[model samples]
Target: MPALFPLLRGRVLCSGALGGRKPDARVYARALAQLGARAAHTLFVDDLFVNVRGARAAGLEADTVRDARGLRRVLKRYGLA
Candidate 1:
């Protein structure tokens, strides 16, 4: 992410690596703050389904993607690209 998305740098939670569990809404809230957005208006793009699901479960729209193009499509779908 740092290499490909230097501009989007922010807090990163590696919760999936420790356990396939979702972070709570509060965690998402703090994370979203780093991006200057609220969870309700945020879109999380991740390659792993578990992470995507976790983000969704935490009250943010999310998508499972494999590459930058896929990510771009997601952003475009949300009018963010």
Candidate 2:
């Protein structure tokens, strides 16, 4: 993943690493804490609506994208592409 998106290197989080799963606000909190990031400044992207909603409920800007193209589109919309 890092080879394709260098900016993601050392910045990916999984359920195990965060000790929680999707749709859980605690998971988002843990991830933000680990990254030293503010929820308002973060853009959380997931393919599942439940996860995206969870992010939003946790006070983050969230989006859902099912493919790389969709992901790119969302990133572009946010000026991160």
Q: Give the TM-score of candidate 2.
A: 0.91
TM-score of each: 0.63, 0.91
Query: Which candidate wins on lDDT?
Result: 2
Cα lDDT listed for each candidate:
0.69, 0.89
Residues 1-81, candidate 2: write the lDDT tens digits.
Answer: 234467887677896778878988999999999999999999999999999999999999999999988988998898887
Worst 10 residues of 1 by lDDT: 11-20
Model 1 C-alpha lDDT per residue in residues 1-81, reported as the tens digit of each score: 335466555545454443434545555655666557777877777788877777888889999899978877887798866
- Which ten residues in a row are the worst by lDDT in model 2? 1-10
- Deviating ranges (above 4 Å) for candidate 2: 1-4
User: Model 1 compared with the native: what TM-score?
Assistant: 0.63
Q: In candidate 1, how many Å is residue 4 off?
A: 9.6
